[model samples]
Target chain A: MSLSSTNSFEKSPVEKSDKGTPDHGECLKVLSLVLDQEATDEEQAYFKQHIENCMPYYEIYNVDKAIKSMIKDRCLNQKTPSDLVESIKSKIYQQAD
Target chain B: MSDNKRQSYSQREKEKTFEQEFLPHIDSMYNFAYRLTFDEDDAKDLVQDTYLKAYRFIESFEKGTNAKAWLFRILKNSFINDFRKKSKQPAKVDYQEVETFYNSEDVDKSITTDLRIETVQDMIGDEISNALNSLDVDFRTVIILCDLEGFKYDEMAKILDIPIGTVRSRLHRARNLLKERLKEYAQKMGYKN
Candidate 1:
């Protein structure tokens, strides 16, 4: 399997008709929105309607993880670039010298 | 006046041009640089360098255009042309080696699970930073301007000097990538079953 490969939004694999195979793709898509609970009524309705026809918990889990990724903390120091500025300045001076 | 006076007058003119046209925008530039560099120090220096470069070529600026976008484009080009280079001392990055950095990983952070919104609210400020960093530089830059900075598609298209479709497609993919990262983080933290 190609490492960079991913299912496109238009052709999500979770959209199967039968309930036998879980719709992991669609679940993944919706789960991202689920994190916020901020989906529009229409968005929620669409998800419910689609899932009702073909349930896919696998896809749901995938989406869940995506949402968590969205909400993960990765903040760095906000006021941390002054030293880098000095470093760059020093480099420029050295180059000139 | 002597030629010495002429030279001094031009130097002052250059300083005033920089102060008025470029210095005033330093904070906004710093904000963009912070997001771009993922480090405050690098961002500050990048902005300062961008200002200096802008100063050097202040004559090239046209009479009336979007100065913000022009400055940003110059800054971004400078990043690609200068700062992105690998150091002679052999640091972690090599373009080919880092190529797979964008490849998808098989892990949690899927989009299907239900995490409490409060958990998200608790983590978003920090998580937003995480999500931004997780992305490759290209994807991160696009998402930062579009999502975090709230630039519209057309404006982003103009600023990035790319077709609108590229912006839209990149953003769609970047958001997906970010979602997956958050999901992985939550699962690692045992935020969900």
Candidate 2:
């Protein structure tokens, strides 16, 4: 089934300044930190400001966020088969015995 | 109590503590194992092997400090060692190839094809799961640890036995690859923007 058609892309700020436009490498670094939620307040501010002025950074940021959300929602929910736990316990108990 | 009695009591106490601290992480551990091995039976065996090793090396584990992380480290190492031996397939990524690809001009063209949010939002959970599973083992591991398990970068560094910088770089590459793989699916879902 196809995903819902929700236009979640944020509008890039119309205000453009030549000063804060980060190159691809810097954009990636900030994007990684941003995704991990490890970016410092200053780093976050820098990233927020850069993305507003640069379409590439904004697009990459949103794409990465969506991918992470998809993974967390989907892949993490795989149920641990019930028998695996029993099997592990029995194996551990056998070792003890 | 006799010396022998005292030693046995301590041993039993250690075992009990180990059980208490480690057992609760079974579901998470199993989920990780399943993702790594991609088969139920293999996942079961991997978890069993990991627990056995954890028990054997219980002396090395410091008590009450991130038991989940400790166990995960062991499980990940065991998977690497055992998965290699059992599969008899080379699981190693050629860094030179990856480096060349990323450094190439093609990356600039590819990056412009932004993954449509509607495409990802429309996907079923299994689609996402399969997309994640399609990633290289190293990439998948970082995503699973960082995103799925909510491990901090430092924690991932510890678990994967790499420096924190490597963790960041690997995670960056991993997410980028996932976006590339999913883009095709997004296009199929009729995503326009």
TM-score winner among the candidates?
A: 2
Kindly report the docking quality category of candidate 2. Answer: acceptable
User: Which 10 consecutive residues of model 2 chain B have the lowest summed lDDT?
Assistant: B1-10
Report the Cα lDDT for residue B187, model 1. Answer: 76
Off by over 4 Å in 2: A1-21, B1-9, B97-111
lDDT of 1: 0.54
Q: Interface RMSD, all models, one decimal each?
A: 7.8, 10.2
DockQ (Cα-based) per candidate? 0.15, 0.26
**C-alpha lDDT (0 to 100) for residue B97 of candidate 2:** 36
Q: After superposition, how far is residue A16 of candidate 1 from its true place, in Å?
A: 21
lDDT of 2 by residue, B18-102 (tens): 6798889988898999999888888888888888887777767765568889889989988888885788757655454323333
Pairs that clash in candidate 2: A2-B122, A3-B122, A4-B122
